[model samples]
Target: MSDNSGFFERVYEVCRKIPEGKVTSYGAIAKYLGAARSARMVGWAMNSSHNLEDVPAHRVVNRNGVLTGKHHFGGTNAMQQLLEEEGVQVKKLQILDFEKHFWDPMKELPQEI
Candidate 1:
């Protein structure tokens, strides 16, 4: 499972654009990258993104609006706390207002160069 540099960069770029209190899914990013089944690859890139200062990885969740990255967070319940601080409500690993907070780059983003 070699992590290519460009692929990771693409993941970070997309992940960085997710607004605070809003969320996106790995499958969406993979599709945006033109690899529809590469959602796991997107997750791999995110797991390796330890040095990104501005990329709020916590803002991303599973397709079902579940906070699936809780184990990866440092402090106990940190991912939920971060999301809540950004005005996203979470209840037992699920986002409260999912429809309003979900962000789909394919719809909201400008065309790529």
Candidate 2:
């Protein structure tokens, strides 16, 4: 695959590894993919990844735990509901007490995958 395609695949692979109800930022994803400043690129790829079979796009959000991708979700307010159902409290589009629930995959992820 070309570099762009490979990068997207890598993004999807990492995104797929995120557990349900958990969220990670585009910046973090980019960092994990060795593209520390390409968070916007990651978001672009995600926005265009409608057919990806493995990426749970809903489980990814902004660095502040904001549901910035809610517009792309399948149902109205589905992203928030999904996170809440997963035990995350959300208010005004903010993940309540984000420091408590944010999953730093960079630190928590295994060295080898």
TM-score top scorer: 1
Looking at model 1, the pairs that clash are none
Q: After superposition, how far is residue 26 of candidate 1 from its true place, in Å?
A: 0.7
Model 1 CA deviation exceeding 4 Å by range: 1-3
lDDT tens readout by residue for model 2, 58-85: 7778998888888887748987887888
Model 2's alpha-carbon lDDT is 0.81
What tens-digit string does per-residue lDDT give for candidate 1 at 1-113? Answer: 34567887888898999988799988888888887898888887877776777888888788999988777787489899999999999999999989899999899787531
50: Cα error in model 1, Å:
2.4
TM-scores, one per candidate: 0.91, 0.85
TM-score of 2: 0.85
With candidate 1 superimposed using the best TM-score fit, by how many Å does residue 34's alpha carbon deviate from the native? 0.8
Give the alpha-carbon lDDT of every model: 0.84, 0.81
